[model samples]
Target chain A: MIGCGWGLVYGVLNSLSNIMLLPSAPFISIRPQIALPMAVGILLNPPAGFVVGFIGNMIGDGISGFGIWKFWNWHLANGLMGFIPGLIRYFGIVKIGTVREFGILQMSVVLASGIAVAFAVLLDVCFLHHMTFPSSFPSWILPAFLTDAVNGFVLVPVILLAFRKILLTLEIRTICLVTILLLLAVFSTAVSITLSILDDLVSQEAVIENFYIAGIVSVFLLVVGFLASVVFVRRFTDPVIRMSRASQEVESGHYDLSLLDPVSSRNDELGRLSRVLQKMAKTVQERERSLRQQVQDLQIKIDRKRKDEEVREIVETDYFRELKKKAKAFRSS
Target chain B: MAKIIAIHSFRGGTGKSNTTANLACLLAREGYRVGMVDTDIQSPGIHVLFDLDTNDIPYALNDYLWGKCDIARAAYDVTKTLGADATGRLFLVPSSIRAGDIARVLHYGYDVTLLKEGYRQLIRQLPLDYLFIDTHPGINEETLMSIATTDVLLIILRPDQQDYQGTAVTVEVSRQLEVPEMYIVLNKVPVRVDREALAAKAVSAYDCPVVGVLPHDEDMLDLGSSGIFSLRYPDHIISREMRRIVQRLTP
Candidate 1:
């Protein structure tokens, strides 16, 4: 239920944000395709898919202009999209075994979500706002449909793929660093937006002054972000350099050194290099094992050769002694 | 510096991921340090080839994106999982499979440049001899950025009409991006199909080197993302073809 609630919130927020941003870039509008699956996954699993989507979407929507009342209805409609898909899949009405199957499921939910959002928008415009469905409904609907389809078909899969890729990479420290960066971005964006809005409500001179202040602040934040990222990258690179050095040492038969700690710093790059070193260490260990086996085999061969030499020496001594005794006896006779 | 090789297909189901995984594994077997990244974050599935269960994945690309973990922490070292004969190291950076991560990213969207930075970071930090990026099929910010940064770009396609057109688009994009080296890998060709003719036709059409023409192998389907195909069936025809592709990739 909480998942569904979160999905509802995310759906509404995602729809609202897309609507707000739709005027500027029609091709890049937000859609509920991702939110729907996310909501369903979250509602079913909690704090997994639904919560993130819900929180993200709500934040995005809140950034737009939906009122509390309208937000609730929007949430309900959006939440339904996720709930329906989950229920259908759970009931075995839809199968999701392969990549293709998953794609189809995403399309269906997205299409359904698009329809629901359209209805919600229509309700808001006609009944709530007391305005006619804009002369732009046809144009808007098509783009919305396309955008949602793209979101479902393209974006959803990409997200899943990225998720899977990240899991495989297993760079937790990078994740934390990136998260901090994103939070900073969000915080910076919020502050900038707030300042601009405040400046708008004030006098011209105050607005100008505020704009100047905000610009300076934005630049400072951006610089900080860049510097932090650079530091992180540098930290990441240091380990790779160390790992390479260690690898070179190992190549020269120095196996006592261990891999550098990639996560010693908050840099994502170093952590990745550390992983490579760890991998290199494993390869070195295997080589060491093979080398050990070869040495043992060589030792056995050496022992066998020594035994053969001892046998040859004994045979030679006996033959020579016999020959000498025969010659003496012959001479004496 | 490790050479970053990106494998892309214009259309879906062109065997991009499988080909990437196989090539990476084959290179690793030959004592090369190879890393594979499934940058198709929206629909990630390469972990299956590495026998990685979702439960086993503690971090992912989504986690990296959401600031929950470092990209390196997301890399799973599957070399040990592969076995004793596998001398090369294989680390996989998988995308998140969780629905929430997917939704949050789509709804919020992150900086495309950040993803590019992540790629460069992965290459430099991992010190990868080869970083294979299995990208999403079509052109996107991430795909274009990866193409722009890659040292070698391998475009995978089948002998289908749709694929031909799509491959042309990707080839053109890679050319426009001025990728240092570009090669086309013709995959899933029928056994009865004339290899020489296919290669010639594809080469003439793309005006690029046809690195390898791999026959459709039933063994791949039977394995079904269970493990790296080339490593499991080293002597198989498909694996042999994959080796040819790897040879071209190597200096």
Candidate 2:
């Protein structure tokens, strides 16, 4: 019952967002809000995610006068986007702590987007007469895949982090901050360019030409910016990875700090951390060595004392004295 | 039959001579006829423990080995040195302490077989219950000869790394030589080490019984090589440890 209620609300919101699309291809426009239902699905149970996504997309098509049954395959695809992320919770990956966990979450989001879009195109080929191969692929498939994947990848982690489901590590915090800034920069640039192209009093052909040129430039910038941010973020995080591995070696009683040499040589906070860790390992190793030596020495001391007391008791015995006297007397006779 | 017991070590300064002197004295005090031979001709030190003047020794083991005298002539009855209440006999076969005698022996190594024969002759002539051979550290011809003929071989070593490694080599060689009974005595151990653990480690490393772990007693160090530790300070920890080791070696 709660799933149905969420589905209705999500459907209405999705329809409203769909109406505000930026012009792109003839049949496919950029849809950024598609991640909302998917995020909600993953946050809740799989059933809730599936119902909300499927019902919402149907209601959206119905309200847009496209008829609910017209894009049934796309509705199912949207339902799957929510369903896949919900599976992450089943796998006990609701909380992201390490880099590996975060990578898995992001990869799943991208894969879900690709799979959903591909499913829709497959359905269209088998049943519907709308999408054709190669020509329709860039317009229908590429736009849907890129927009949904980018949105889900960016927004889901942000939502999870905000909900405190994902632990906020230094690496996560920096990446999130940088991503938000980069998104803002990209969105404002594209928005201003789009608004100017729309408001132009030039001919329709000129408007179309200007819009195409702006879209091409925006897409090119997005790809370049994403790649650049990845490389830039890696520089700050790589040392952390190296230091973590070095600490594991130290924990296992290996005092060799040569592996952390490169990290310690750097002139940054991470470098200082690496040096501190190396120092800690050295201190521990020294303590263990001294302790072992002390233990060995203590054993000898205790043994000496104990053994001496034992011999003293034997020598002082009356029996031993009597035996000595008898032996001396026997020798004399 | 007299038991020939050889006290050996792989490295010097492991208290082998001190231990040999003390063991001999302790046994003699217990009414057993003990004979101690300073087979370490190059640096004979057991004579000093008995307070025997090197110049007073008219016929030493070197003289016996050089065919100048009988082995019994080199044996000195030092039972009086035990100072009263020592019911048993103690005779010492002092090595020639003269620098030329030492140089001559080292330059032209003495007959290893003759030295073994001398030990037998000394034991039989003195009617000794036990004859202790104090050997030089490391594997030399005389040391090997002494080890091969001994009824018991006591390997002395400190708890130091160098001593431990050298001791292992000596132990392995003794085992290969098929010595009847072999025991390890960890000497000069610091008071801080765990005695039982060190004994266990030594036993496991060499596969030999550990007779004693003698700590670095201040009395022993202060006394130096002047006197027998067990006889001087009979109740001292080091002396007691020596007694225990002697008891094991004899039995």
Candidate 3:
């Protein structure tokens, strides 16, 4: 039920992107729709991903007045794009928890796009008897792979983020910013290629070639940037996370702060903060101990009010008054 | 005229008798002719502390209260018993320890007036500079009569909850009687207690001067009531504290 419902939605979205007149290569439409099935593949099951991609592409082709069975190779290519990332289910990762898992999710998307496009090219060459090899590589294979790979790479994390499948840690936040930059780079390059085609600024073949190269270069840059961000952000935020955990320990009345030694020795603001926290805990512990001792030694319980009343009972008597008179008379005598 | 000093407590076993015996020896050591009367008629134990043997009593305070003898006849010059080097004379009017004598005083009760007259007779006869009244614990008619005539009142107590409450009442009573001078003496305090601090606390507690906070002495306990603690351990910590109390009371 989920597969058919999502497949129809993907088909409608694909048709909508086509109508939007976005910057794209000749005969290769800019397909942000590529991320939808890949996200579903990773989020849902692999078979569900295949069903969404295959059936969705078929519905899309039929809606655009292109015969669905005519380019059956393209439907299979899209299906494989979703199916490869869906293989992530075997890693026991229902959601991205660490930097390594995030890398795997993105790498699978890129890997799936390359293999899927290659599979289609091989089928078109062997079964359909499509003309030419080296010439077809640039126009069909390169364009197909770059379009799917870049779109899926940039948008899958975004979809996963929106769906709450990824935790918004420091590493994930940096990666989110990096994805937006990649999308901007991809968008600008596509627009320049489209302008080149429309205004006749350069030869179409040369322009298309440069577009594919720029797309691939940006993907590598995004990968390197993602890795560097993971390293840098993890370094900055781990100490904070550790200190937060130690503070919780202190709150619960456990003053064993052996874990904070490294953080406290850093000679930074956080280290100074750690030292202050440690001193506060020690002071609290000392006060508690001394309080217990003082309660024993310093207190001598006596009720003065009650004693004053009791003393009044003996003094306010006729016998005491007469005795006081006789005692005073004798002392003067 | 001798200055009458009454030593008292609201509860027994606060070392009241022992402290009286120690102070008498301490005062005489300073060459003041001191006279002490064991007014703890119901259960008198002060005579034992002065090493006054049971058989040596020709007359106790019981004889004078009964009008059987003059109060001076009951007075014994106990100064020589503390050693011949003692300069000033020290006298003790010990309470009788005989079974019938104790029972008659408890049963018929002594005239409280005679105690003041006896104190006057002792001062005139022996010409004492200081007269010590070793009072029985707790409030009684005679205890009040003794307190009423005193020039100075010393309330002794131990570091105990019952003692704390009892001493507080005794302090209020002495204050109401308009005693000329008043002070507290904390005795048999735990040796580990901070003496200076306890002394300060007691002063603030009673709104009265604290002349002493005496530590519990093992030797004093070992000696029990058979001998004077100040004379036996002249330079002992307890003796030193007692001497300090004497210094505060010297005027």
DockQ of 2: 0.05
Error of 2 at B208 (Å): 0.5
**Where does candidate 3 clash, by residue pair?**
none
Q: Evaluate fnat for each of the predicted models and list the values in order.
A: 0.00, 0.09, 0.55
TM-score of chain A of each: 0.45, 0.57, 0.62
Model 2, B236: alpha-carbon shift in Å?
Answer: 1.8
Give the TM-score, chain B only, in order for the candidates.
0.95, 0.97, 0.96
Candidate 3 TM-score to native: 0.51
Q: Against the true structure, what is each candidate's TM-score? A: 0.42, 0.46, 0.51
**Best-to-worst TM-score order:** 3, 2, 1
What is candidate 2's lDDT per residue for A24-135, written digit by digit as tens?
A: 6555545655666667766777777778788888997888778989999999998888778777776678777666677777787888889989999999999996988978
Superposition error at B117 for model 2 (Å): 0.7
Candidate 1 local lDDT, B138-209, one digit each (tens): 776667666766778999888776677667667665664567789989888766667777787778777899
DockQ: which candidate is best?
Answer: 3
Instruction: Return the top candidate by TM-score.
Output: 3
lDDT, candidate 3, B67-153, per-residue tens: 999999998888975677877889999989998999998889978888888888899899899999999899988889888889899
Candidate 1 runs further than 4 Å off = A1-333
